[model samples]
Target: MASIPTILTTIFLFFLRSTISQQIHSNPDCTGRWIHIRRLPSRFNLDLLTNCSQYPLFDDFCPYLPNHGLGQKTHAKSHSWFRTDPMMLELIFHRRMLEYPCLTPDPNSANAVYLPYYTGIDALRYLYGPDVNSSAEHGLELFDFVKEQDSPNIWARHKGHDHFLVMARPAWDFSQPLINDPPIWGTSFLELPEFYNLTVLTFEARAWPWQEQAVPYPTSFHPPNLSFLESWIHRVARSRRSTLMLFAGGGGVSATPNIRRSIRDECENDTKNGTNGGYVKLCDVVDCSNGICEHDPIRYMRPMMEASFCLQPPGDTPTRRSTFDSILAGCIPVFFEDLSAKTQYTWHLPEEEYGEFSVFIPKEEVVFKGLKILDVLMGIPRDRVMKMRERVLELMPRVIYRRHGSSVDFRSNKKDAFDIAIEGTLQRIKSRLQEVAVL
Candidate 1:
């Protein structure tokens, strides 16, 4: 009974809704998804490094890019430039040395490049959607070649070739040469001998590990380094005009007496001793138990949420899980040490407001100096502590990552840190792309 106009409009609306749904559900094909630990199809699995002539090459150019190019930069020496006798059948290839970008907010734009290599299979799991496992081997080699050709190094040794540069910044330590001090083909980007028409495409940027000068990548790219910690520490120290605090992390390792003792001491000092320092605590009550203490969710998070100063001492090496917990608990983290938190979070609270959320302390100062805990406690002001606590609560959404299994809908038993990194990375990349000028 609908009129023609109304009927047409309804049809259009239905189509539009269906189109939007498809887009939302669709995942990137193998080309866009990064590689991980998966097998490639027999056709693409060919390691051109060892068998270059076996592949179909058009006037020396392979019809498809090789696999080592997908995830991270390949360091294999045998995959480098091909040494041929002009018959095209006897061509032998070796791994070409390539330079990946370093992590830096203000990277050297003049000649910097990115190359995603040694692709992680786990990272691409979501991109392939539910059927990712079936298509695991679909475009492995092409993706790898895409990464390699897009790299800035551009096979410095094999310059005069028609190839796309797979630019990606290294995520781990790849500078150690298996052979000599700069491997066979290992040459700087600027020093590479140019012999081809190359289009540079960047993968993700290299993270921490490269000192500011050692690598041409962003320090915040991979994770936090001593510098990131120092940056935050200096910020907090300047804002609160106080030394940062430390406490054991949560759960098994975190429920130690040191953390509880610190809490009690801080509460008593603030109440009776006129101690200016405040207290914030993070305890996953469900996971911890001592004969004397009862697990109370409200009690555990309340004091921390209300307190201006929270301690974020990491429980494990290489990462500070406490930083994530403290933020969600609504307390400002006084990060006095580095547990590689920066690697996990890059778009953390900004610098101007750094003091408003958390305080950072250098490893040298906190671990080596060994100052009295009381002296550190007395230094921070109560008023500023409250302000920082408020800031933390405000920034919690951006900082916390939720995990509720694979259900599209929210569920129980959530996991946090790793998911937070993925969300943060996506946001950062989106913001970065918006800044590019239209040509």
Candidate 2:
């Protein structure tokens, strides 16, 4: 009894619904293609491991994990694993890429090529050892290898612009000048003109040349699968936060200003006075200088989960691995420097206002003017605090590097840090490719 137009509208609606359902089930985010450069000498990566015992922080750096560094069993009763030397991102990124679905064996079919050079670990071999010349030699060798590559390959295809290197250390570490009055730590690998156009994914990037992208520092929590990740998220969300704010770091020294010391002093002094009518719980500072602050996940994560805010000051560099860990624990980060998060991590953080997930107090206000840390955090409304915490939780997956060989499909809604980074890198390459085509 329905008119022709009514029947046609019903059929059109049904077809549209089916199309949307198909799109929802499709793997769109993991569509980028990449090829790993296997031509580099194995010695660059393998040589470091041959004498792993001599490397600095050997125990922290060289733990043999069963699942391709997913880590060994923390205990027989649970599936939880622990990893150290978050600076080992170069190794992990390379391993994860092999298993990444977007990786293609053929370079001709790829949009971007990855150079899996262990630049950080290799530098550590010489920087920490007695051989300074050996360090410089390593840098020269890598430069020569890339410079010698044939044309029509990934490096020459786009004049090294389409090629990328993932480094575990900050950009300054590799890009240090050869001649300087004060003599900085790092090699001249980044100083080569041949690498000017290449993209470098580093823990912290310098302000200039926009090709240096900042990725999340690796954290201790590598969930075995999606279920474990989901469970932790739920647990942290419901965890009763008893403390107003927490600071877990040693008193800063000469090269590093004593802002951390000042923060610790204020936190301890406030705790003694029973301040904020006993509502504020100021915890003790963890002495990192004593080696007690290394590789203990529970010690670090528990307090972060229980605290409303985690204080982040500049470490040896402006960035700290603890910033990402705080985000993973769903505790909102309070940064003292703009470079800590705002200026550095544009690729991973929200493009909109940062106030949605974090709080920033100028370093001078806290150190020079002697502003109260507890009072500042207490001023934020309870509802706003809840909203910030939620946003931090939402950002957890993007900051975490999931376990390699995990059964979880990255193309699904559960995209991890690796997924996000690859997608972003691919998109950048695609944009560059389009620009080149137009020119």
Superposition TM-score, candidate 1 onto the true structure:
0.37
TM-score each candidate: 0.37, 0.85
Candidate 2 C-alpha lDDT tens digits along 1-439:
2333343354345334433433343234435664445446666764454454575553435453233444444555555456456667876786676655555545665678787777787777656766554433546776667667534455566777677878888988877665543545776667767677777889998998667888998777777688888898999999888777777665464454466866777766764333553444655454566545556766778888888888888877899888988898888899998888888888788757689999988888877887877778888998999999999999998888877657654336687778778877877777877777798
Off by over 4 Å in 1: 1-246, 250-308, 314-318, 337-344, 402-439
Best by TM-score: 2
| TM-score: model 2 vs. ground truth | 0.85
Which candidate number would show the highest lDDT if scored against the true structure? 2
- Per-residue lDDT tens digits for candidate 1, residues 1-439, read 2233343354335334433432343233312212111122222222222232232321222311222111111233422111111111101000111100111121122122222221222112212233233332323344454435434243332231212222222222112223343233212221222311222222122343211111111111111122332343343333432323434334333444443344434433443332333323222122233411121233334344334445654433334433554565555676644334443334354545665677765545544454434455446676776676667655553443221112332211222222333233333333433443231
The local distance difference test score of each candidate is 0.32, 0.71
Worst 10 residues of 1 by lDDT: 91-100
RMSD of each: 19.2, 12.0
